[model samples]
Target chain A: MIGAAQLLPFSLLGALVGADVVSFPQAMLSRPIVAATLGGALAGNVAAGVLTGAVLEMVAMETLPVGASRYPEWGSASLVGGAIAGWHPVMRPGAINHGVFVGIATAWAGGWSMYALRRLNGVWAERALPAMEAGSRRAVMSLQLRGLTADLFRAAIVTAIALLVWTPINDYALAHWTVGRAAAHSILAAAAAAVAGGAIWRQSHGAAGSKWYLLAGAVLGVVLVIVA
Target chain B: MTASDRAPTTIAPALSWSARIAVFTRMFAVQGSWNYETMLGPGIGFCAEPALRELPGGPDGPAYRDALARETRYFNAHPYLAAVAIGALVRAELEGRPAGQIERFRTAMCGPLGSLGDRLVWAGWLPFCSLVALLAFGLHASPLVIVLLFLGLYNAGHVALRAWGVSTGWRSGLRVAASLGSPLLQRGPQYLARAVLFLAGLALPLAIARVIGRRGLEIPSHDWKIALPLAALFAIVLAALLVRLPARVEGWRAALVVLAVLILISIAR
Candidate 1:
């Protein structure tokens, strides 16, 4: 079991990053790559963090976060990924795979948590209506601060719960999983590639001149890769 | 008198520099208190509070109360783009415009600003930056470098947009909508969209190739093994079907489908 002392910093980090998604300071620090890296850094395993983050980043690419539509919550989820990968430390076969799996699972759960938090916020907003209607400065500030605080705690709780639930599972999977490194990596890379491809296809399929533009970008990327 | 005609008498910049800063800072919390019913309504009113407090009528006055109630009705837009609306609304309030005109202006701006912001930030900019970060990470760049690159590149565009949006809206009020329609905004997302697609195409193949190469998979050069290629072709076809399906394929479903295919491939081998 991960100690509370060890989990505390990551939980806080999750809160800050989660809040960044929609609440405040939307500086993209909440992106899976960044959040996972930070989580890994705190856990003393940067490389594992990078690996987990890169995979999660590909999956996260498809999410648009448009308007009020519910989407995967990447911030706390990446923390879960990075923490698991970091705790394992050893680059055993399927270690990164376990991290990715846990990360995706956490993200799925995080989506539901976000919906619930929104509902909670709705309740608080409802309760604050009279003062807000009266233009009470204290009331307005309190409501905003209260909403932000609620989000912070929600993220923290989600991160803590995900870590508690998944760390042992990841540890067991890493120890017992029979998948070869190359096979696991291949499946992961292909899956990520396919998802990324589908997202690009969805975005560019209808726009005029987008096909040509996509072609040009693809060529440029290939040239860069070949040169490097 | 027209809102603009009576502007000189009533719109004497009641907001101090500090008050403007407060408003701008509050813009960050425009969605802090969001709810489905009002959908940013309360948050918008909350953001406008600092300015509302500073209006000629004190906080308890009818004007301030009216303005606050007017803003809390219903409002929803991209938080970043809503800065423009906030700035314009501030001007409207200060100019003593009718609440109806202000509400109409805000309601009108919501759809366009929201859509434009969604297209530019979400669809265009995010994917492009994410691909760049993915490529950087894939190439084994330091995590710090990758993080800095993603944050720096993304925020540079977004912060500039937010600042420009507010200032432009302040200067032009509702006319700022026309300015947002400029070719630069229109072409920016289009170009970024193309770049994102291109990056995905380039990155996906290369990633698959690297994994295959690392695994020492021999196909064309060694045994003319067609299984991998066939599987890939099948995956592509599946992906195409998912994309074309009338119903939206949730992310998890797509992921499950991909994983299932991989499992089948592994079993077949």
Candidate 2:
């Protein structure tokens, strides 16, 4: 069971980060790196949070949140992942992998919650149509505020619930995990690299003039990596 | 004829700077009430309500009601460029344009606004900034610096875009199409897209290197062990670059499947 003290702040953090996804102030504090760091800090493990976030960020690169398309809600979900990983604070394989797996699940659920909230907003809009048609300021404010408030609550609840449900699972998985560190991390890296590669291909393939830039950047990247 | 019969000579006296500020600030929440039926229509109205209340007849006036009601109708645009639509719409409203003409303008503006904002912000600037931040992480930048750099750079560009959109839209009004023709709108996407590709090219290798370097990966002290992994990772990335993904399948989605199977394998073990 999560202590109430821990639950409240994390819930609040999730709410704020989640809201930043599409609601108030899209300042990108919801980016996996930022959100995960915050989540990790809250859990007393900043380095672990950053490492888990870096991995998550790689996977996230493929998501293009365009035109209200259903994409993973990485913000609060990453926070949950960060928190899980942070609690252990070990540079081991299973903790990071377990955190990431749980985060992905949370993000998947968060996406659904967002979809549901949008539907709810649709219903509220239908109900408010008559008053809005008459130009009721009160009606407009009510719908807007209600939608915003609901999104916050949805994120908070999702984060809290994911934490409660997954903490034990993560613990158990870590406890039983028999994989070696190199094996576990190498596979994760390969998968992440594959995802990044795919994303690069998608962007450059039909675009004009971007390919050349990609080539030049690739050469430069090699030099940088070698020198660094 | 009433004094109201005369068209306003200037927009300034009719709508003050303060009103414009209110509209711009509210524009930040332009996606707050996004829904399937109206998309951002309600959000557009919410942002415009303050300005609508400031119409010639004030909040209680029929004109205010008409403007608010009209704005509350179906409308959609990228959240950022919606400011442009809102600014232009406000101008049309203040100028006493015919309702049909204003509606047509709003309809016409949506597609362009959506397309432009998507290309510039979503497909271009966002990816470009993300890659830069990723590169920093690969180079071992502090987490705080990475976060600050990403947020600061991204926000500065976007907030400026928003402010510029509102100002330009208001200035151009119904002729906002001409403003859209500016090099910034037309050429900005191409430049940013290229930048993204460049950064993607540079950052991705380092990313793979970082992954390979993580503590979980163990390699013997042999010099070849170090070089071998890098070479292999590079080859894999190159193959990935050449491989075209079928439509509707993304890298992450495929990775997730692979990951899930791997997780099962681990748990089963």
Best by DockQ: 2
TM-score of chain B of 1: 0.82
lDDT per residue, candidate 1, B87-158, as tens digits?
Answer: 888777777777678888978988988998998888888888888888776565678898898889988988
**Consecutive 10-residue window with the lowest summed lDDT within model 2 chain A:** A180-189
Candidate 2 docking band: medium
Q: What TM-score should be assigned to candidate 2?
A: 0.93
For all predicted structures, in order, the TM-scores are: 0.89, 0.93
Least accurate 10 contiguous residues by lDDT in model 1 chain B: B216-225
Give lDDT tens digits, candidate 2, residues B1-269.
Answer: 21235364345335776787889888877878888889999998898887777676788777878888889889988889898988888877777777888889989998999988888887778777788888887787877888888899889988998998888888788888898888978988877777877887788677666655632334433532455365447446644653654657666666667667766778789
Candidate lDDT (C-alpha), each: 0.73, 0.78
Interface RMSD of 2: 2.8
For residue B35, what is the lDDT in candidate 1? Answer: 72
Model 1 misplacement above 4 A: A219-228, B1-14, B206-238, B256-269
